[model samples]
Target: MTPIRPLPSYLVQRFHGWRATTYQENRAWYRRLAESGQHPRAMVISCCDSRVHVTSIFGADEGEFFIHRNIANLVPPYNPDGGYHGTSAAVEYAVTSLGVAHIVVLGHSSCGGVKGCHDMCRGLAPELDEKTSFVGRWMDILRPGFQKVAHLPDGEILRALEMQAVLTSLENLLTFPFVRTAVEADRLTLHGLWSDTGEGLLETYDPARGLFHPV
Candidate 1:
């Protein structure tokens, strides 16, 4: 195997500085966390977009949340076909092992994944339409969502699809037997959120109203 290159000097220096300060300020807290293991109350599934700061938005501390990130924060329907399912594996671990009380699906404005789905559905992005495209296959999970908003005008499609992504994930979560069992037993709850990155606004999905409202 090829030897991996060393990390950049600036990042290494920054890491050292952060380690020193953080350990100095919270050594006992860090030690306690290591000893106790994680018992987070919530699990957050969100986009891999660097602009979406899950920790910063929630002001979460170490071990406060179990977070999983993917291209568009999508969750596939439950399929126990013995296939390789990274997202499903994470959900299983979170629901069965972690025993988390809540699962939050967070979608954001101007998501490239959502835009790609829109473009592909509209025949604008042929590359994403290819069968070998991993992103295309992954985004296929949101095809149903795109269909629901396909009748809307071009200007309104992206935002609708973004919210749809959150709703889709929430719906898929229920397909998992463990998740459904926990929810039915009143042990777990589900939440959906959409963020307007440009405006720094957060909106939550209201299942009763079937809409997203600003928080």
Candidate 2:
């Protein structure tokens, strides 16, 4: 079922007017994209949270970034038949087909997935039956993340867990053969990014320093 009675006039008018100007600026670009197909510079794996808009946050134009959004911006291990291969397939396409130079795992503060991990850690989450199966399985990807930050202060745990998840996904990305091959050949780079929604801050993970610092 869908509801359709609350359309805001201003927004509706703006959207309608936008396409004309947008098409003018991007007509050729769209034609080229349609003809040559996507050759994005980077692939951004980000949370589906409405507040975190990767393209808008980075000011990237159409076809500039290939993005995949999931409940918690996670990258599961390469499982060819784990029922749904949406996210993994997106990564494969970005690396192998699109030849994206960089793959960035972007995590953010106040993530629902992080919150779910916290709940699962406390043994307060729902049972792992068939009906509630995916929640348990999906959140398992962040088990090490929660474990890594378990000893930290309660207030800091969520953010730390989120950051650790980004690192975990970065490692998980290498589980795919194409990604590993690209990285080894110097055709790919992996990055972890954490955005503080409340404070409007962005940090990039530094593998050498083992910490995320201002970008």
Q: Global lDDT of each model?
A: 0.95, 0.88
What are the per-residue Cα lDDT tens digits for candidate 2 across 85-111?
889989988988888999999999999
Over 1-215, each residue of candidate 1 has an lDDT whose tens digit, in order, gives 77898899999999999889987799999999999999999999999999999999989999989999999999999999999999999999998999999999999999999999988988999999999999999999999999999999878999999999999999999999999999999999999999988899999999999999998
Question: Which whole-number lDDT from 0 to 100 does residue 25 have in model 2?
Answer: 75
Best by lDDT: 1
Ten contiguous residues with the weakest lDDT in model 1:
1-10
In model 1, the clashing pairs are none
Off by over 4 Å in 2: 1-14, 127-133
* Global fold similarity of model 2 (TM-score): 0.89
